[model samples]
Target chain A: MTTVIRELGDEQRELVLNMGPHHPSTHGVLRFVLHTDGEVMRKAVPEIGYLHRGLEKIAESTTYPGYVPYTDRVNYLEAMFANEAFSKAIESLSDIEVPERAQYLRAIAGELNRIASHNITIGCITMDLGAITPFVHLLRERETINDLIEALCGQRVTHHYVRIGGVAYDADDNWLKQVEKFLNHFEAIIEELDNLIVYNEILVKRMADVAVITADDAVGFGLVGPNLRASGVDWDLRRDMPYGIYPKLDFDVPIGAGEKGTVGDCFDRFVVRVRELKQSCRIIRQCINNIPDGDIIGNVSRKIKPPKGEVYSCVEGARGELGVYVVSDGTEKPYRVKWRSGSFSAMSIIEHISEGLMIADLVAVIATLDVIAPETDR
Target chain B: MTSEALIDYVKGLLGDKTKWADPEAGDNFLTVASEDWKNICQTLATDKKCSLTYLRNFTGTDYPEDDEIELTAHTFSYSEKHGLIIKTRISREAAVCDTLSKIWPAAIWYEREIFDLLGVSFNNHPDLRRILMPEDWVGHPLRKDYKQQETYRGIPTTRPA
Candidate 1:
């Protein structure tokens, strides 16, 4: 093979490079305009909106009930959270009461979605860092969770399972049994994943102490979920705000202690998600064991016309605190709907923090942050 | 501090700057003049009694009847565990307000988004450009009166039926 090369002059100038919009590691058509001095990155400006479908604009035109499926497009990775956030916004606006059984189902489905999301986060991060085996292993576990979710909700990616008042359907005993079996098996697989990737020497070196974000910075940037907890913020909407059935379920909110690296580093972020995976399993097990029997749906009006008011409903999604702000003008269609996505703010901090890191480490930073482009652009 | 106390604190801090306070809206909702938007945001974010360090959401809603666009900001204090919503109304003709990007870095993107979608401009924003739309795209799509262009660069803008 013939190679074409250009000789560098004595003058040193920064090289500006475009990373994605099509690159696999960019994760959903996200582009990074990187300024690099050789291997070191001087600045990384993330150019998003490639996936912007005007979801907020769509929400305004669609009726309250008609918008549930559209919410899935906001963050397909954790569609249940978006569904719950939108539905909860409607329920709050219309004064509808969700049944207890439905609340339990929401918790169960939400936790399972969290696990599935974390699987992709962990697997993709590992794969991006050059390890292929762990990605396959993680995907194998993810497929099992997807099967369980598909059985419960009847769809895989955009499971429009949650409704305005409650879930689409109640979990049968068979589905609950499958979830219980999956949780038991998932516990062992998580340990296997940890052994395979977390403690691996190369992965640790690549992630640990790279792209460190302080607790102050995390709070200022509005980081949430594992990213915020990894920085030692000790805040989780499920625990702090106590929405849905989160209060009834007992599970530990994992915070990064920096056991293997500096606190708030990329490694800590990765570890936080792994710990959350285990915690999610614990919550799912508890939800299955103590699930109460009742109506799946609530006494919500089928017309779905909320009075003239506004409401903001938030859920601790797989990525972070996903909030849906809905404004109703005494009409079937919402006046305006704003999706306050955690990934949007998380992605904003990249420019500030990417100044000193190497070009390769930026990938680790991006992966650890788990910035899903659709959610950010939405 | 409880949400009520936070509301009282903000009401006392801003005093006459606050146009109205809606206690029924929940989350300490208050509407203030566009001129005092930045000052109120700074106070809410930095004040110890109301350390609303988190800028949860920033968006603009078009109210055609009022001939103004209402800019709403939701802030949360992790330490206090309380939240507040502040609204500022700007005339639709000159929809400009001081940016809170300085107070909360997260507002940078939010401001750009509001600017891109609602045609509201945020003065003093470090980088004010269309975020979710193409640079060449015309009109703010989220505006109530916006009319979708038939074509862009001679390409059909709508799906062919």
Candidate 2:
């Protein structure tokens, strides 16, 4: 690694700088060896694996149903998506039919989790830019959603809500009422947040036209969710692939329109996430009103030993496409389990995009992409 | 194109170089030899009808019982909204295959990860190193026959059961 960095540095008299295996702005336990000639970076080589816990290896030893809680640890910010993806994989392997009401409940939980996740991404972008006030306001709104999720799943962060065939718990009338109320109130909160910091001059100046990723590059690098959409790609797994109750829900997939600057820039990524928060609220509102009364879990067997086969199931996670590839060998435990996370792919693109970018703008790019360390390392 | 038609199209393009797995099962893929892996991927990426621009998921699985390791690349087309899975296997003794990083930039890290955990090496990959594990880590941990090291740089890796 040193030889490679020296080879790149020898071209010009460059200063080598090490930024965090512990830097707050690097997101989590990520280190970048930067080759910079005083503030402009020639290359930023990201060094990862600080948070890798061998979740895939552990899955080979754990029972099919016992691995649900571990998926929560994959991406704690959007634990519902991880849980749903794993559950869908198992269901697909076994050909278990999830109850209609359970599908609606899973969608509701997932959207609420999406809103909570976007709150952190938008808040952290502003916070990383030195505007601390917006983070406080966003966290306040996130707390209400977290409290609502706690009520729904009986756990706060790592809610193991989705089971193999269906969901673990069902939503009652009172919980639905609270979710509706929160969506009604969150609509205005988003407007307030936009006014407070999203449209602030300093934030826009720091973010707009910085680290622009073109549409073709985005597709080639396999950017998903908001990052891909910000690059002007019209694709969303929920809409294009149509999983669960997303096909039944009526909502719009908001793409980057370059409202503030050039398309696929940092500002566009930030704005696309902000718009997604509203869209998530819209989807949750629809789910709340249209939830039906039925069984939450299906008639799944006690021993979940699916026939020998393999399946790849994914969900539109908070960050992007969170996928689980399961290869079962007619056993109670999974033969092999591989996670395809969005952050891992997003992190790989940093070396390509970080060329010629200022040190501070790199922070903006990482924050705007919302690359969570656990998801990337997992 | 649908999964069936996609398999047929790829079979027609690659002819004897590829063999299409039965589409009746889950995720039917085209099985190609190790030498033909890069050529088939290049054909898929550049072909006007296929044009699989996005490499959705790329991973490797260890099957020591069969004395072989399988690598799977799941490629998707944004314009057509269709996807195809490609599988290639190499002997466990010689786990080397041609890299697809030239075709899709997304394959760089994915190839490195497969090299890191499953002990598969990609030929001509720009940078192939341990990704999710330490550089000095001993053996591939994802392999079914792997044994955990007692300690790493004086830090114990195992705990009491």
Candidate 3:
């Protein structure tokens, strides 16, 4: 149906505003075709792909080892998760063995990456809800984790730390010590954030019961990560489809059963990510304790050619399921390489969730969905 | 679940529409006719035994050299049944498939994406706009023989080969 925007007066015509593919508050280069009558939105249809780098097409040309750097650029917030997803998918496709030490190291970095990503999720959600303090506070903690990534791979945000088979560098003594110190402070900050955002009444007024989606719609729409779990569909790739050392880790997959108001709203989505932060910490602590010493890199085939078959390996990305489908013709180059991006599902929620709300609320909804534009565009 | 039973079960449900045993259980193919797209998806999804609720992704690959366009639907049942990925191809002429967006609303953008990058049109998509590329863009870039000389807005690009 063509959305009909009627004018309030002859002088005051309905305005169709171009939000942006360059607005920083848009989170990334996400443009919105927002149909509004001044402040209230009639319809807000998101226009994506302003930052489309076409990584999947690029992967078909690059070697298996050459694809690692590309994943770093896919999801800039959760760089390690994208890296791990690519590396793990290649490892699974080739049936290469990653050592226990490497696996443990991968788990630590992955969970830390999850924490950093969650911090952004919670921080940005709160900021979008008009609480600026939480955004800065959360970023202050996210930078330390970025420092750890920098120590490993020399770059912070776009970390090329994970290779095809295993992590590029092992967590040395100092790195472990730094991680332990951060974990202590991280716990306290999370507590403060809970008090500030989760329990706050003003945040609840803006978030709770806004843009509610049912469990049926959640599954039907294939919402993943905290979004799916927030809607009460217990489909986590880590536990259900075990990859790496996640199955061994002791933690609960947190769900949002409408603590404040109802499931599948902005607050519940934020709560799910907040709860996941604690669970991610639990997994990281277990990883730190049981981490054995061994080689970091695994035995990836030199030529890195798989059988003339298709293999898709999906890991539990910080946002959702991140998979890479490789169609190799028993050659160094792949016939096709498709990156199953997390944000694709996250952004798809816009179709169902953006129907009836103010334009500002639409931004709030997108921020709560926590989609990375590069990941979606790629 | 045993591969044999999983294979047999899928065969019974899909009948002639799916080729279960022909492609091994390790992320391989089963051809699907364009007519059978929605039924096959609904069967794979709604059947309580095979609650293939989680859609991993839907992507298409264009093989201009082979004159075949491939579309793959990677799905898994969350209620502890099985995971099956349907791989199908269409001869370059009738490269259209009925979209499963009605069955799985998540397929909206995904089908649009396949439509966007690979030019595999999804018949009856609600809003089949170019998702990742500008609306005015000419040819799909992911096709094997496709070119990316000028962008959607007619801005010419020069990059070292």
Best by lDDT: 2
* Candidate 3 residue lDDT tens string, A1-378: 234455768677666667777775688888777777768766677788988988878877888777788888888877788788777666766778888888888888888888988888888888877889988988989899889878867888888887887878877888888888899989988788777768899888888898887888877777778888888887787887688887788788888788988877888888889888888888888888888888988876667876666778777878887778877777787778888776878778775667668877887788888888888887
Which is superior by lDDT, 1 or 2?
2
Output the TM-score of candidate 3: 0.93
Candidate 1 per-residue C-alpha lDDT over A1-378 given as tens digits, one digit per residue, 9 for 90 to 100: 112223347765677788887887888988888877779988899998888998988887888899999999999899999999999988887778999999999999999999899999999999999998888988888899889889887899999999988889778899899888888888999888777778999999999889999998998888988999999989999989998888887889889888778899999999999889999998988888899999999987768888777888899999889998888888889999999998998999999999979989998999999999999887
Please give the interface root mean square deviation for model 2, in Å.
1.6
Best by DockQ: 2
Model 3 stretches with alpha carbons more than 4 Å out: A1-15, A37-39, B1-4, B21-26, B150-154
How much RMSD separates candidate 3 from the native structure? 2.8
What would the per-residue lDDT of candidate 2 be over residues B1-161, giving only the tens digit for each residue? 98778777887888888876763335677888888889889999999999999999999999998999999998899897789888999999889999899999999999999999999998999999999999999999999899999999999987868
Native interface contacts kept by each candidate, as a fraction = 0.62, 0.72, 0.66
Interface RMSD for every prediction, one decimal? 1.9, 1.6, 2.2
The Cα local distance difference test for each model comes to: 0.88, 0.90, 0.79
TM-score of 1: 0.96
After TM-score superposition, what is the CA distance of residue B3 in candidate 3 from its true location, in Å?
5.2
Candidate 2 lDDT, A1-378, residue by residue in tens: 342334445475777888888898988899899988778999899889999999999999999999999999998899999999999998987889999999999999999999999999998999999999888988999999889988887898999999988998888899899998888899999898888888899999998899999999898888999999999998899999999999998888889888888999999999999999888988988887888889999989888998887888899998889999998889999999999999988889999999999999999989988889998888
Of 2 and 3, the candidate ahead on DockQ is 2
lDDT tens digits, residue span B1-161, model 3:
55456667778877777754243323655667766767887887887777788776788888777798988888876676467777677766667888888878888988888888888877888988788877778878788888875543555576547
Predicted model with the maximum TM-score: 2
Evaluate residue A270 in candidate 2 and report its C-alpha lDDT on the 0 to 100 scale. Answer: 95
